[model samples]
Target chain A: MPTGAEWAIIALSLKVAAAAILLTLPLAFALAWLLARKRFAGRMLLDTVVHLPLVLPPVVTGWLLLLFFGQSGAGGRALQALFGTTLMFRWTGAALAAGIMALPLMVRAIRLSLEAIDRRLESAARTLGATAWRAFATITLPLALPGIGAAMVLGFARSLGEFGATITFVSNVPGETRTLPLAIYTALQVPGAEDSVTRLAIASVVLSLAALLVSEWLVRKGGRHVL
Target chain B: MSFDLAIEVPRGDRTVSVTIAPASGITALFGPSGVGKTTVLDVVAGLVRPSSGHVRVAGETLFDAAAGIALPPERRGCGYVFQDGRLFPHMSVQGNLTYGWKLAPPAQRFMTLAEAADFLGITALLDRTPRTLSGGEAQRVAIGRALLSGPRALLMDEPLSSLDENRRDGILQVIERIRDDLALPILYVSHDRAEVDRLAAQVVELA
Candidate 1:
């Protein structure tokens, strides 16, 4: 049987992953909409930049996040001075790292959905007295719901399993931010802890599988709506 | 209702200029493909801006290049039906019908939600999403959605052009019923002379 601390780690991991997904969704939608609909200079560059995290090693991404958002970093110092907020070695930093890692996945899913939308539907809405923003809210967004749902599920799953970035940014601190993946890594490192490690590993696998199943269900639902 | 439009658009090497004074009933812009028939409607619908021209629909000046006045599509009050029925895929039949109804001004609103559904015989499909609808059924909903907006004029650009002969005939009947029942003028675009003959009160051929 798993210890209470192990269960707490799993729950905390789920919460952090859910938070990451929730935080990134609106930003993903905005970026995806811009990519799908707009034509401008630096468009290709922006696309490549957004996809950089997906291509880079997770540790490298986490390292970069720490450089930009750590205590000594430019924005980090300013944020600390202004609001006394600190991201380094904190649960919030874990969420930040996870969200950054998950952003590309969310954006890609949403962009595909946004691209699949019929431009004629938007035109039809405009003709029917819907302004551009109104048309987007009432027509474009609803049409793209399936894509958004898929993105959220994928992002959340990715966040839950995020290890390299989370450890690099916030480290593994129990009762604060020692998420499931980190705890699993810690358990494996400790001698004579095979049973605990096995429990945590199984928990991680089950959570990942469940998330994937949910994602599949959402994608199928979305596909039906898109058609 | 009356509409006056004079616009010039470049199509490859040729510049298509249309200057017409439109009166009530279906005015079909009959022409071959790529003759700028769709472009003319685009200008009227505020989808395209003319190099030098003006558009006045039912005494309301929709566009004037001289004065740099151009109304957006939302302000044009022209209900457009495209070649494909652009019903909201996420919305049920009733939700799609009500979308345009909500946009119409209270005084301008002539049809209620139930009335619009009844007009299209889509009362039963009201709760169903557009993906489940057949092509003919989708077109009927599109027509209902457009009608519910209480448009000053209706612009249909080859609305039945994608359907088969049987589907086309079915949609044509619904369209005819709409034309007879509604007082709004319609600018119907098509390349098919038979369809033009079937629905148009006046024909304007574009080259």
Candidate 2:
């Protein structure tokens, strides 16, 4: 059983993960669709860039984010000018880092599903008077539902586990940027915080396991029709 | 209710050139496998771009390469029933049947949902998913879906090849009714001589 403060930390972690998923979902789906369907110049380059975060060290990814989104950095300064807000050392910054870390998984899951779709069905839709957008909305999107669901769950799980990028991008701050992993790290430095660490670790394992089970179920469901 | 197509399409290392002009009835494009018979239908349906060609259907110029006019598949109003019957697996038979009908303009719609279902003998299968349907049942639903879309023409590619003899005869009767009663221009593709003879008003061979 976690104390009230610990519970707050858990809640913050969930909020960050949820926000990260929301932020990344649409962009991930769009990139996935483009990568799966189109043939164009620099497609391979685009694919490599998308997968860079997965292969690169979490700290490296975090450094890149910080470089681009730091208070004085171009994106950070532009965002400040446009929105009159800053993400430095904030929960929103944690979400940005988590989302970037989770993006590759989301895009990969969605791209696989999109590629698996029978393009002939889209052709059928077109011949039946559906426009390109309508065909994708009706036929392609529905068929890719299970994969999209799996992508969301996988992304959420990855976001929940995200530590290096979040810490590097937004230094841990209690009740603000202090999510589960950061809280656990904070507890680890104390000599008598073993019990707290155990509790948090258990919660993290349970959340990750649940997400994996749900993703697996979605993949199985999608497999029946997605050939 | 006619088609005049003169097109050349690239296929791998080779190119397939074909010219077809059929007026007001079923015209069968008969050929063995790998002869690019289906490619011709694809060209007419605007699924494939021709290197140099013109496609005129029902007095509308669908594609004119020289003039730089190419109508997309949706705008062409071609009701194409593919070889495998590509029914949307997510939707029920009723949903698939009405997908095109819902897209068509109200004034252009000559057939209602119930009428199409009744015409194709698929009224009973409307609530079922496509996965539950037999081959013949799926084909009928496909045909029904195409007809309900208010198309000026139809392109069927080996629509009956997958069915058994009994099921084929059943669909054959339905097709005959479509030819004699509905009077829509049809571009039917099949390699079977007997099937072509039974259905086509004119046969064009691809060699």
Candidate 3:
């Protein structure tokens, strides 16, 4: 592969991961809030399901995604029948896979921070003539902001590195579904491709490090006020 | 405003049943620690729903078990000033003070944001967040936040307990000023006899 092709893979990976993070954040925040704030039946089951992608083998997770979201499956059929959309072997599929993989970590980070908040602050807001939703929007949501930022950063980074599920759910196809990890793997498999592997490896490290540094900086900037 | 409340609240292994109809002016709930003074205020503020009882404020029904009318805290129109002054960390002093005031219904709003800030002597700290505030400053801001909400009544639970002597005296003076300045009733919860003696017009002692 030429240098431009390698850069294309990196660009495609970033776009996929960014899309995945966008898809994941709102749902992760809601799930985290449900787990952290409200008490309800089946909470444990919901929590377990959200974390399944973490404990299960990445390949298994990918297979499960394929089973549900594939063209023949109920989820896939429903989407296709209703919206004429397809996820199988597409970039959208890659995002779905990565999003599922990163959700647990995202939820956990947000939940931890939300649980640390003083409920009394919300109560105080309520006494100040604020409705429950208003209190949440003004008091609880803003207080949980730092954590939300951290969760987004974590989710983005996890998506960037996502591989197993992506390859399983949406097979590697250059410029279509092949992300940096898939590209790197392909480079490593060929004979006399050591030079390509070394370059991609260096690129991967630099990209991941840059992302991590950005997140750390963002979290720290927001963390000062919360702390 | 005045109230008629008869409630039985389960407190761990014990039950705290207190019935007292507070008269006008500051009705101080005076009691030692753990005797349910705060609990009574909580019930009156609509923060605690009694298993069975009625809470009538003035001519309105805030909570009536028999009638199945239990207004949530926000609808009760009662401003609560907590002991620790639970100011929203994200908002500046001005935002905290006007948070509820701004949210209040147009007809229900009595105090303007500027008036509240001026009343609490927090006009200077309008742009400052709670993180930089002193304990007394935070409580003042909390009080301003509560009062500006245009509540039908005020429920202050040991609002000066956490303060030092100087700060306590300062807050006590502010409390006295609020009593004279505002028309709303105050349900002041305090364990200190000095506070009760200095401020309360009618003392309801709990055991």
TM-score, one value per model: 0.94, 0.96, 0.95
Greater-TM-score candidate between 1 and 2? 2
Candidate 3 lDDT tens digits, A1-227:
33988888888888998999899999999999999988999999999999998999999999988999888889999999999999988899999999999999999989987987888888888888778898888888887887888888788889988999999999998888989889889988899988888888777788788878877886787677666
lDDT of 2: 0.93
**What is the C-alpha lDDT profile of model 2 across A1-227, one tens digit per residue?**
98898889889999999999999999999999999999999999999999998999999999998999998899999999999888889999999999999999999999999998999999999999999999999999999999899999999999999999889999899988999999999999999999999999888998899999999999999887776
Ranking of all predicted structures according to TM-score, beginning with the best and ending with the worst: 2, 3, 1
lDDT of 1 by residue, A39-116 (tens): 999999999999998999999998898898887899799889998999888888899889989999999999998998
Give the number of the best model, judged by TM-score.
2
Error of 2 at A80 (Å): 3.2
lDDT of 1 by residue, B122-186 (tens): 89998998889888788888888888888888888898877778888777887787678776788
* Stretches of model 1 off by over 4 angstroms after superposition: B10-14, B164-180
Indicate which candidate wins on DockQ.
Answer: 2
Q: Weakest 10 consecutive residues, lDDT, candidate 2 chain A?
A: A218-227
**What is the overall TM-score of model 2 with all chains considered together?**
0.96
Q: What are the clashing pairs of model 3? A: none
